[model samples]
Target: MISGDVDAELRRLADDPSFPHRDAARHAIRFRAEGDVSDLVAIEDDPHPCAMTDVVFAMAGSKRTWLNWVPMPAEAICNVANEVGSRRAEGEDLGLVSLALSAAEPASAITASERVMGRVELGIGDFPAPDIRMPLRRGRYAIWRYDGTDPVPAVPAPSGAAIRVLHEVGGEPWSSPLSGYVQAEPLGALPLADLLGLLAHLPGPPDTPRWEYLAKSTPTYWYRLLQPWVCLGILRHAADEPWATSTRREVLLDLALGIEDWTADAALFALVTAAYRESELRAEVHQVVRARLNAAASAPRLVTIEESLAHLMLITPGCTADDRALATAVLARAAEAGEEDEDEQAPPPSKAEKRRWWQRRG
Candidate 1:
């Protein structure tokens, strides 16, 4: 339950005219710090909208944390029209995994999540797979009620299905189901070698039915949403070791250049982070940096590309002069984009432009 003081503080922040993203993020962190159902309901009810990164960071910041939101039977059919619209306006998609990973007490939360998932029947046909992820971290898992609304067009619900209408603060309505969450079994942490072995089984051959299904189910791209988390885990495990020892240099390189922007960003983060601790990885980091700079030359203002470039420059010292030159050109173009952004009326707090979520983990 939300403490009297916490409820009042959230209310005060919501009423303040100058609530910023940082404030919203700090408040969002309360989800992990205090795992009370009423507290989450209060945070959800708060008028100040939160950015997707704020929520992600809160959920993934620690291994022991988890969050499972089980709506009251009376609240199960909630019209999340505003919630849906706000997320779309901010270019975000929420899943059960994202919300449930914020619980402070993972053991109870996991049990609670499993019980809730068992009661909610899975939707049939192309009802869009719920954002299901297993073992977000050691002992932690998440299970939220509503999946994203972006797949509404591509994955229509069967007729007569009980669909929930979602909306942003002021955005149009979109239909989404109130029950798509599924139970995910928790796994123990594996050694680097074992983790690599498990990862090798993913994104299997192109002709398979599973691959075809994934292509149709995922939003916009076929990239695995878990790619970043997995990459980050690998980086954390091998930061102090030589790249050759892990036998996964090629894996990181492939992920760094993957089609999914977030996955690529995570791969680059892993590469650069490792390069800082292991001099042996510097050469590969430089090669990736150069490739990214060249690819970003024409469209320098792209947020993800610029973010990768900035992270490399910040962490990897003594960058090659050629890379520096290319980076300079990209920043020059990005500056022009910033000017345009300044002139446009500011977007909503949740929609405001900012760095990628992984970079802000620090």
Candidate 2:
């Protein structure tokens, strides 16, 4: 049974005419009933093409069912390829293309793979099929090939050609946002003190709506700035220090709460790392994060928030019970709203049909 808080949230979501959270809420409800989010895969059949790309990335990251991601539907793959093609043609960055190529089995997306390969071949003068070599249990490693072949023994690392392709298309322009700041120093480096100073000076909690702050600044600037710290263990290092000041913690927490859309991953990384070092801060961080997620659950673009949550669960597998519960509750609200919408739109079934549906399950 759904908890009272979750049920009330669902009711509020359902009654809202804007219906921003419809899809996510519905998926949540189904997840609660089925006990597995993957059970809602059928929802992908008619998803927005761009949203489907995000779904593909999310499913790939989910180690529990990564193998099943190979044979995605052809139409969906085509849509993603077309998006890549259009973006490439317009001279836009091909970061998404690189991700698609990395995650998809070339055989499963034969035609789309060919198109991407054609671009790489033309750009780099080679047909190197990039492979992601992942280490497995017991001193084993699995090499995933674009051609969908069985895993092979890890041998020589990926070729320079493949690495070049990844370099050219793998990341966004601001992948390292701190470069400019660090480079400005005479030594072309930023000390930890300076880095902390820069972070503290970033936009703080505002009296205006959070979205207004987001709109005024580049959406990903803060996340990009914080990512390096998260990756280099700087955030963790700071949290572990007994002398760490409240100023540092407050700056980090404010940034964490300010996160929305794609920046959620960075926030999760920072917050989770901080919480891991300071156990006392865990509950407070969870509360703040849950509130942020609840507010975003009703936004028009949920893919960013969804992907953020998925990445958080993926990285901190052992600490996700609370997050999972919160996710289920939010999704359940979406699901209930979906049912109401469907009920309003769908024609009433005959008594015989309803009886037959129930009888079939028995």
User: Candidates' TM-scores?
Assistant: 0.35, 0.32
lDDT of 2 by residue, 1-362 (tens): 11245544544554667865455445534543444424233233224524433233233222221111111122223444545545664567755322222132212133223333232221111222222112111121111232233222122443333323222221222211122112222211223343333222222122234423432332222223333232222343343445246433544454444423122334445554444334566666556555555555543322223434533442332335666776766556545744664666454653222211211010
Query: Could you tell me which residue pairs clash in candidate 2?
Result: 25-334, 25-335, 26-334, 26-335, 28-331, 29-332, 106-146
Error of 2 at 289 (Å): 2.4
Point out the worst 10-residue segment of candidate 1 by lDDT. 176-185
RMSD each, Å: 19.7, 23.1
| Candidate number achieving the greatest TM-score relative to the actual structure | 1
Candidate 2 Cα deviation (angstroms), residue 254: 1.9
Cα deviation at 52, candidate 1, in Å, is: 34
